[model samples]
Target chain A: MTFGQAILEALESLNGNKMRSGLTVLGIVIGVAAVIAMLAVGNGAQATITGSISDIGTNLLFVFSGGMEGGPRGGPGGGRSGNNDRPLTLGDAEAIADPFAAPSVELVAPVIQGNGALTFSGENTTTSISGITPAYFTVRNMQVAEGEVINEEHILGRMSVVVLGPETAVNLFGHADGIVGETIRIEGQPFRVIGVLVEKGGGAFGSEDNAAYVPFTTAQARLIKRGALDEVDVIFVQAISAEAVPLAVEEISNVIRARHRTPIGYDDFTVFTQQDFLSTFETITGVLTIFLGGIAGISLLVGGIGIMNIMLVSVTERTREIGLRKALGARKRDILLQFLTESSLLSLIGGIIGIMFGWFIAFVVGQVAAATGNDFVPVVGVDAILLSTGFSAVIGLFFGIYPASRAANLEPVEALRYE
Target chain B: MDRVIEARGLTKTYKMGEIEVHALRGVSFEIERGEVLSIMGPSGSGKSTMMNTLGCLDRPTSGEYILDGESVAEMTDDQLASVRNRKVGFVFQSFNLLSRLTALGNVELPLRYAGIAEGRREKARAALEAVGLQDRMTHRPYELSGGQQQRVAVARALVNNPAIIMADEPTGNLDSKVGREIMNLLLNLNKELGTTLIIVTHDPNIAAQTQRVIRLRDGELDPENNETIVRKK
Candidate 1:
């Protein structure tokens, strides 16, 4: 018999018993749906993380003075440069920021960070107090939401002016709207909140919204009390462009090594760019997405088994019909193709429906994430859809062979005699 | 003198566990082209076994059968199936029409199997018309009466234009009036289309209407019984 005729016959048989056919294909539907949904969620999470990390700064590098001994490290640039014992100095920052010393370094800001209790109008809260130059805002992509950022005068004159992060302003002053110009006592010294920073959510490193910023000179003279006159914990460096980061890192490394007079192989410092952190995060999330996709594939396998089980039962039920077809001139291959076609059609239909359903589910998830203020976009790739549909079709064919052969091998006399 | 069916000492044995039941024992017969023949016997008389052997649905344990010039005994199952498709047709006692198919669909089955692609529907319609089932072509088996279902079976048997038609108790489940109508239809096909007809029945009255009758007792045709009867009417 022709394949078209056999397919028509199979479809008629399926149509005859709609409920059983629907139930049989339901397994495949669920299998494909789970696979697509898992991929969507995994990819969405990866996208969100990548976006937030990039939002921290553009073409920036973090230079730290401490050595992280061994094991796989985060991509080579941004983190806490050092502790107080072997801290970076203002002179080091000046040398790195000098255009002739490091041609690719566009800007550098010294950072001194400490945790302190801030009391504003009898409301006390513990928060991170950061020491930075006016250039810190430019290097770290910070913006003043309510008032001015730290000025050059504030840095050189050692003024007690501070800028509160959006969340910190709300916490210390009880309202972010009027927090600018308010006097918040830090470590028993009163500092005027000159500005409130704009809102930015959490990133891979941590949230910046809970920190309060002050001038590096004021922090050095009044609060930290470290013995060294020019000591700072970290330095943020911005490159002229993204392609210049590697060159900027190499130049800064050479300048710092000369300033410290450190030996070549035992340099006590690490320099990492934002690109490094991105590659590291990509590797981690890529492996996780595949692991999740693999787990979802197991359900597709179960779905294939369901198709096989139902196909076998159908062969048993249609024994006499097979005999009749055989007697009417159908070859063994004809019978085998008929059953195989039926199973593949089942899986194909199920896969199509599952894809649509999976997309709908993922769209809903994206909407919910948006409602909760997260930047998650559900991405359903074409490759994912094609791979899943193709895999399901193969599953149908693989699971269909035994049952089709069983039907094909039936003896005409025995099958005809089977009531 | 053209023999459509030639059997030489056909033997069939069934192995039931350790016991062997001889269903056919050295039975020889020759049926000429366009001949009307009947094989009648009681239960366990080897008549059904002989019909199965002649229809190419089975092979003899130790004998030879030549159907329409092909040596069926040595043919593989697939080869025999092809031979059956090209040269043999069958009508079952239970009107073995696929229940899900309409009368037209059932009738087109053999033509479809024969790979007659273009005019299958037209040929199926003609076959159904020949069997007086043209009015019921769109009805399913359950919708048709027992006699009408048998007529659909006959239409299916004729649609492929096979050389021989084997009817196994074709009227077994019908009333006497309907049974006679089925018999008349088969006889008319033999007369009008020059088709070979072989009817397997337990009713002597049905056997008496055919041109030649053969009887089987136990596993063999009894020669001493002189059971080959020629009907003059």
Candidate 2:
């Protein structure tokens, strides 16, 4: 028989038992939908994380006052390990800032952070306070939304003036705007509010809008003292361009190594570029995507088994019909093709519908994520769709082989006599 | 006479577990082209076995059997299928029409297996017309009466225009009136188309309508009951 005739026969048989065919197709539908939705969700999470990480200025390098003993650290104020490690000092930051010593370095902002409770009138909230210089805004991509930023005079005169991040401002005072001229007591010490930073969204290390900034000299002289008076916690180094990040890292590493009197490869500090963090996150998320897709593939396999089961039932039920066709001179290949076509057609139909259902699931997930103030959007790629549908079709054909062959190998006389 | 079938000492043996049952034992017969013949016997008389062998549905154990000038006894399964498609048509007692298809679709099945693509609908319609089922071409088996369903089967059998048509108790499911009508239809179609017809029946009245009758008492033909009827032209 021709392929067209086989298709027609398959369609008729499947139509004859609509309930059974529909139930069989539903198995594949759920399998494909799960695969697509799971994969899309995985991809979306990866995109959001990487997007936020890349948002943190790809040209910047972070230098911490510790050795590279543990795995790569995330954000600022990570753990410091090893007894041989020396604290990062303001002198090292100044040296790295010198254009002659580090040509690729555009700016360096030394930071000393401590947690302090700030009170405005009766309302009080505790948040991390960072001591930063004028270059901190440029290096960290921060902006002043109200009043003015800390100037050179504030650092030279050791003025007790502070800048609040948007979230911190909202917590201390009623709102971010018009809170510049207000005075807030930090650790029971009165400091005048100088400015409020613009709102920057959350990232890999949590929300950036939850801290307050003060002048570096004021913090070093009056607050946050660790080892030396000029000791700093971390230094934010800005490269001339994204391509110069490696050069900036090398120069900063050399300057710190020389200052700390450490041998090669045994430095007292660690320097990390944005690319390092990006690759680490990508590897983690890529594996997660595959793992989730693999789990969803199990359901697809179950769906294929469903197809096989239904096909077997159909073959047994139509034994007499098979005998009749054979008696009418139908070859073995014709019977095989007819049954295979039925199974494949069932799965193909299921695959198409599953794609739509999976897309809907992904869309709903994205909508829910956005509603909860999350910067996540599920991404359904064409490759995911194609992979699932093609895999389902192949699964149908593979599982159908046993039943179709069983039908084809039937003896005409015995099949006719089968009741 | 142009011979359409030649059976020389045809024998068929079956193994029912440890016991051997000889279904056909050295039965020999020759059928001329365009002749109407019948085989009549009671249960366990090897009448079904003879019909199966003559219809090319099964091979004899040890015999040289030829149908329409082709040796069919030693043909492979696929080759036998081809031979059945090209040379033999069958009308079953239960009217083995596909319930899902209409009369025309059932009639077109043989031509489809024969790989004839073009004019299939016309050829099927013509065969239905020949069987007086032209008006019932679009009716499914469930929608037609028993006689009409048998007529559709007859149309399907004749559509391929094979060398022989084998009817195994064609009128067994119908009442006497309907059975007589079906017998007359088969005999008339044989005379009109000059196609060799073989009917296996237990009814002597049905067998008497044919030009020749072969009677079997056991696995072998009974010569005493075997008779040829000469019909007045």
Candidate maximizing DockQ: 2
CAPRI class assigned to model 1: medium
Count of backbone clashes for each model?
5, 0
Runs of candidate 1 with Cα error greater than 4 angstroms are: A70-85, A225-229, A258-267, B18-21
Interface RMSD of each: 1.2, 0.8
Model 2 lDDT per residue over A1-419, tens place: 78898889889888988999999999999999999999999999999989988888999898887677754442234555666666788899999999999999998999888888999899999999899999999888888998899989999999999999999999978788998778899888899998999988886667779998999998877767666667888899999999999988988888888888987667767898888889989999999999999999999999999999999998999999998888889888888898999999999989999999999999999999999988899999999999999999999899999999999989888887788
Q: Using TM-score as the measure, which candidate wins?
A: 2
- Model 2 regions more than 4 Å off: A74-78, B227-233
Compute DockQ for each candidate against the true complex. Answer: 0.70, 0.75
Query: Best candidate, lDDT-wise?
Result: 2
Instruction: Name the DockQ score for candidate 1.
Output: 0.70
